[model samples]
Target: MASHRKTRQHPKALKAMTLALAGAAGATAFDGTGQAAPHPTPAQVKGRVDALYQEAEVATQHYNGAREEAGAARAELARLQDEAVRRTQKLNAAKAELGTMAGRQYRSGGVDPTVRLMMSADPQRYLDGATVLERAGSHQANAVAGYARRLGSVRQVRDRARTTAERLERSEAALKRQRVTIVRKLDAAEALLDRLTDEQRRQMSPGAGPAAAPEDPARSGAQAPSSRAARAVSFAYAALGKPYVWGATGPSAFDCSGLTQAAWKSGGVSLPRTTYTQIGSGPRIDRSELAPGDLVFFYSGISHVGLYIGDGKMIHAPHPGAPVRIAPVDEMPFAAATRPA
Candidate 1:
């Protein structure tokens, strides 16, 4: 009777064990404190998206530089090719004249003067004869020398054209690769943005929240140093809300350095097309010495730049999806500042 009673309770014990295992598996989702970690908030997502966009901007600058180089290289290649063609025409004309001279010599039974001189039995007599021959054929001799010089020049020009063509090809390849990198990074940033709710996207947009308040000029620590600087600052302000377009130095859109380059151009200053080159365009200055129209570069590689507009404020095209706007100078990591002369 005891053995039968134990057998009856076996199924109940098995059911209890199964229920305990399922409850433990459910509990594994929580932390040791017994609370489930929350999902990433909108602000966190925004920060990540902004970082990806910034990286894309860096690649965009590289792409712009490569494109400019490729353009210049193509122009150079075209010029060189034209030169080569002209040189070849000249060479062909000289060769034709030389051939005519050879035919005249053959018809007259006149051997080459150098060969005749070499086979001379009487050296003094041959020298005297050769001097008269040289005076008579001075025009033909000059043509021969000219042809030799032109042939050498044509060879050099052809070689140079070949080299220029190779350089242009390399530049074109680099531009394509940089463009690919920029697209990839921008796509990643857009994917992050897509994950956000409409309200979250709005909060993170430029000029949408309290953090996007208009910068107070009085609060800025510096002032425009010259009329040109002031004009640049004015131009930057006028460009507010313009979209950031990679490699654009334009009336419509701009990248980080493009905005600064265009703004300063309005002030009658020329800046290089890329951030790396632009950094070397002026004298380096301390952050405390910043003034309006001074370029404030950011990131360790100095890949980003903005025009300081005074009172610790700067006007910049921050990144893709963000327009030209005024923000505090410390919005990103500061690398250095420059004052264009």
Candidate 2:
């Protein structure tokens, strides 16, 4: 159920593709001297597949984070663009007003006050006109200054918009690359899975051990710190058996962070889209201090997350081919935990 926009091959199609690739995986490789390479044991294949799945999950997290950032950047860029347009309009209006002032002065024979006084038939009348001209000139000066400031503001907004636009472009490119990497890793992992027998595949699958409905936190002696936490824990339990979709956060499927975010949302606490960001969603807590509904992160990169459901166990989507299910909190490397209120 782990789906991506670009990769929508059904699970059955994926299985077939993997079986085809497994044939190639079993094919003997030739060295420069044409010697046959040794085939990998099922154990080695499982190790490689597990590593590939982890790598894919890391890439998926990066993609999710980049997507979140891109969304924000796009909104910021739009706001900056609107600001620039408004500033440009103001600058233009100032310019037009300054131009109109200059035109009026030209129509009135824009000559020096001293020359106008010398040529005037009535010198007192010309003096009065000069005072009015001086005031007009001051207004024009103010208009020019205002225009300069508006122009500067427009430039600043434009510069910021340009910078944000560039950042969005780079983030988009990175997301594309990360998407490709994830797809490739998932494909390879699936092929490796096909190389193993059903028993071997079950042995290597995530949440393969005793996956069942989680116990009630209150009854299991893992009391939630608050009603909100209890709601999140309950939401996670309801999501059990749903498929793991790399980019999905849904009623039917989810990725690791997606599951956590959705569960927390049901608790009335908004969480970020990726594990990296969710790590900072609330104050960090020690593993010993972990409570039901707390988010438990895994791996050094914080690429995976789970909703703690009490009794030292957590419910998570795990990896592809796994469903939303219960697993030990210590199943993977413990990176950190957070209690989002």
Candidate 3:
């Protein structure tokens, strides 16, 4: 009976032994003797990091091209800022030189829109200085042209700066994230070895961690204007409330260049009518130290003009689509800044 009972239990005993063997095999089934993922080599991490760096390089190249263009525009913009300061001082000086009433009377050879509106006794009086109106119209046209160019330049600079910043931030984050993922993977792999023989742990651990890739050249190349550039900023405060003209060089009434030309004239200098011709007429002052009476040039050929008063603003003929205006340096997307003394 005892022998028969042991025979009946033989199948169960065999099944238990088979189950134990299968579990043991499963535990060692991985390429390693542990049930964990494989650890990657330094070469693999380097390969991935290098690929990321390549992408960053291409992005940086694009950034560099854009940055170069922006540099020119921003330089001009800085000049404009400088002009604004000068204009303000001039305007204040003019105000002090001629009190409110006298100033109004002086401008009322009937130029300013505000004064003209006050003296609108004859609606048809617009034809009185008929030739002057034509000049005003021309001034307006030039102002419009200059402003359009400026707007484009500003947008380009703004966009370039924004994109460059984003590129650097995103690349850094990606690199950091990559390192974090590698660390986590390594930890998991290490945990697997924790249950292994000391020999197995030694084989898996590579002491060195992932390295940072080289930075993109584009990010390295772009530099903002120097502090000297900042000082060159002069703004025309005197041009405030000045009458806008299509084209009349002012004793009163101004087109865009006319305003700039006229303002400089107050400082006792004359600038060319069109901004294009003005480019060659003056010495290109380093954008820093823009002085009162200095003519600020705009556009690639210098087709727009403003008087540098100081602090990144300017008084200029804004546009025909608008009126004679005081605008910020950033308004014109300045191509090149030159001050004609």
Candidate 4:
């Protein structure tokens, strides 16, 4: 009887076991479409984020150029406006003097000078006296010519100011659009990074990642090419942990090009504010010739720059979420190298 009871389990218990097995099978099986969604790996996310940041940097440079143009336009407009005011004042004074002369002539019954001369009994004597009048008339004509020239100049200035203002407005609009695009790209990159797990985030960080390993002493110990180079490298080193702020050329924060420009500036060198221009500021050199303080550019468009600190390492303000830090020189695609000092 005991053996029989063991073989014949309760119906509810048997059903429960069957349902549990079915659920387990369903969990491991394919979905309704018989396909699985692909999840991107951390490395894939990093690569995409890097690309987004690079695009944003390109837009940043355009924004900077527009800002410069707008500033210059504003200054030029102010100068033109001041000159116009001065010219207008001179024109008003000349018109007032001409009006006074017209009032005197009207008060004298508006007789034509030539008619009055012909009507004189002694015409030759009248003609001789007319020399003094001729000289005065010539002076008045000169004054009228001066007023006309000034009026033409004022009109030209107003036209130029108007043109410049219109150009500035267009530039401002383009800058706004660029800023919006940059924000969208940065937001997408941040969302990608946010999807990473805590361990993945830490792993992706330049300060904590395996890629951030220290450089070999021998490679990092090369001497600077000059005193200026040494000073530039030293300045970059002093800014190791500052936050990366777009368009900042600062004592506390910087973008990639801004950091390099500021570093070189501290060394008594003036570099262009944008990576594209900064790359052209010095003679190009081969990567094999890279030394401390040499400027290393990255990407096909040369949109990124960093100061080489020897030992196959470089100091740079990496991106918005990153900071001024040392990284491998080959961290991204190498485009060119330059020696500014």
Candidate 5:
């Protein structure tokens, strides 16, 4: 009686319980925990997406640097291997010469020339000939010593080439890992962006259009300090609306550092391939001293850069999904500036 009552709930209560369970099951789960979590607001999603983009860029820069190092390492390995081959050939030749000498001596009964001279009929004449024989013996000893030296040299060169080959292999592996990291981060960012409404995405990714220029005080006929600088600045302006492609140096798209490098190149100055090295390409300058065509670096790690076009504004390829456009220098946390030319 009482047990039967306990097993039977009110119809309304049972219905409510069923509805609650269904709602819980339908909500989104996070971290694979299977528990429902609150959906993130657009602002929160934007923050996370931006952080992911920054992370991806950092990885992209690392990948670029690693790729450059791998290239040089591969070239060095090739040179070392070539040297090893040449040294081995010389070693083989030396061994063959020594073998020939040994064969000749064996065929001659390997008798002591000095002993033969002592038993000669004309002992003085044979002794005079013994001097020539002694000279020949000395030459054989020198050949053996030369062979040993060549063998040692071949071993040393081969060892060095093997070590270089190993280093090159390691560098190439690191490059592959970095590339994977960059791709994963970028994909995560894109996924987050996909969750947003179209209007939300548009608001979050401002300056995404190729022809949409940012409003800047420097937009009105601003001239660079020098002719070269002027050319660089002009190149940057012409590059407006180009998409940002990590590790790209452009006629089409570019990364932050690539855009700066290409911009300076237009001005007849060559900059290093990475932000960390590009900072040392020219003299360091204060923020107040920034001029048109000067390279402005951002973030503590100096992973980002732009070309200053005066009035405290810079033209840069901001990041993924954004085009080359004008933005205030203060848009990101400023680290340092350089005058590359």
Candidate 6:
């Protein structure tokens, strides 16, 4: 399952507190306005956002480890399978050669009926020759069969090893995905948590109203793979409270793709609109070399994009009905990766 560190405070507890506070504040208001209430304090909102950022940080680490483990397991399985294949081929070839030699010996005109009759008086010699040939043939056949059987046994053991490796790979992959998902929750949780520090909350997003959000990013001055990814994530940090919109790229509102596009542009590269196009355009890369500004594809279809923030993390707009945020690279149900075009 996806890993997450739940807050000491529960959502129900927070709801109850909010209701109590709202009631108290409502009672104190003058003129029975029953009117518009004050928004939460900036400090409260900021606290929630901070919590999300911190959670993302922790989740990122877990995701990184999981991904590495899964990849290693898969590599091991591949190696074992390759060895098994070679062994099987060698065993088959040996068996086939033995079959050819045995077939030729049986099919050859070695027994002559006329010659057998002439050696009737010394039938013992004939019998001895036939027996010697039979024994020699049996020994040769047994040697070839034994070699083939031995190799087959070795192949069987290798196959078992391969199967075990595959199981391990799958488990590791699942673990990696789980950690990634929690990181997304960590991002969304910040939205609800935003109520804690209203001041910092406003800083998460900009509006005509007074400044209420925190400017200090959860991760500050992180050395990213590229200056472009860094700038993009920084811009995203400014969009903490924006509502998630479907397919909306933005100066204001944003969907996951939109947010990624805007952030990468900050670094000077222009990406395509959808995840599919972006994935097709970039250079393919193995996991070990992944860097910021490089587009990572999740679910194998390239439906997600994030600015690599280095250290196994990426700042991104995670999904529909979610906020822009930072998460581990292995997050987004990772399928594969690519460098920017």
Among the numbered candidates, top lDDT falls to 2
TM-score of each: 0.79, 0.77, 0.29, 0.76, 0.76, 0.37
Better of 1 and 6 by TM-score: 1
lDDT of 6 by residue, 63-162 (tens): 4345556666777777777777777777677557655655565579553332332234664453445444444555553444454355556667687776
When summed lDDT is taken over every stretch of 10 residues in candidate 5, the lowest stretch is 111-120
lDDT of 4 by residue, 1-341 (tens): 44554567899999999999888667655453434546688889988998899999888877766776778888988898898899889878866765666567668889445334423577445445444454556654444445455656678888988998898898889889888988998999999999899888777764743224444433466999898988898888788888888878899899888899999999999998788888888899899998898999999988888999887889998888787888888788999999994
Q: What's the CA error at residue 24 for candidate 5, in Å?
A: 5.4
Instruction: State each model's CA lDDT, in order.
Output: 0.80, 0.82, 0.47, 0.79, 0.79, 0.60
Error at 269, model 3, angstroms: 2.2
Off by over 4 Å in 6: 1-39, 108-142, 172-176, 189-341
Model 2 C-alpha lDDT per residue in residues 17-58, reported as the tens digit of each score: 999886665653444233467667777987798789899999
Candidate 3 lDDT, 150-224, residue by residue in tens: 434455555665565565555555545544543454454444444555554334323122211223322423231
Find the number of clashing residue pairs for candidate 1.
Answer: 4
Q: Tens-digit lDDT track for model 5 on 253-321?
A: 999888888988988988878888899998898998888888899888887888988878889888788
**What is residue 177's positional error in candidate 5, in angstroms?**
2.0
- 60-125 in candidate 1: lDDT tens per residue? 888989998999989999999899899899989977877777778878898565444434687456
**How many residue pairs clash in each candidate at the backbone level?**
4, 1, 58, 2, 0, 24
